[model samples]
Target: MSKQPLAPSVADLAPDDSILTPYDYEHLGTYLNLLTADAEVTDWREVSRVVLRIDPAQDPQRAWQAYSSHLARAMWMSKLGHRHLLGDIPSLH
Candidate 1:
């Protein structure tokens, strides 16, 4: 079996496209992690440090922007962006 692709490096802001982009595909794991963290009510600073690799202590604003934007993108992926993925499958029709 082929290995799963590793998540790409976290961006300062996730793409805000109406549909998922190649970057979104690469960051699927990251999005899931962010969603999990949100569900668990994890602290933003900690999530930023661990998942996003942004040091909230050194740059609070940047870290927050990155974390929030990424988390929002994650939510979008679950709510709407996933539909776009279905188009990738070869239809029997």
Candidate 2:
């Protein structure tokens, strides 16, 4: 049987967003995990398997690249990407 579709997360922002990829809809948790791991200065290989579910033992290069790219995007979200998250801002009365 197929898995149930997940509901969209609040972190899945698109307001003024242009750099989003298909992974953005599904991997918000992974992004947060990477952000937290970055704060902790954790190992990427371990995070790749544990958070990204891409085991380096299976495909080392793909796993490494996936982890690196996602981590960078996660950092981007923690920085400039969040500015676009609201999509549109309403005037505060």
Best by TM-score: 1
Encode model 1's per-residue lDDT on 1-93: one tens digit a residue. 555456567888899999777788878889999999999999999999998889999999999999999999999999998898877633322
In model 2, the runs with Cα more than 4 Å from the true position are 1-18, 88-93
Candidate 1 clashing pairs, residues 3+ apart or interchain: none
All candidates' lDDT scores? 0.88, 0.66
- Predict model 2's lDDT versus the native: 0.66
Instruction: Kindly list the per-residue Cα lDDT of model 2 for residues 2-68, writing each as its tens digit.
Output: 5424433322232324565554635567788888987899888888778777788987888787778
lDDT of 1: 0.88
C-alpha positional error of residue 55 in candidate 1 after TM-score superposition, expressed in Å: 0.7
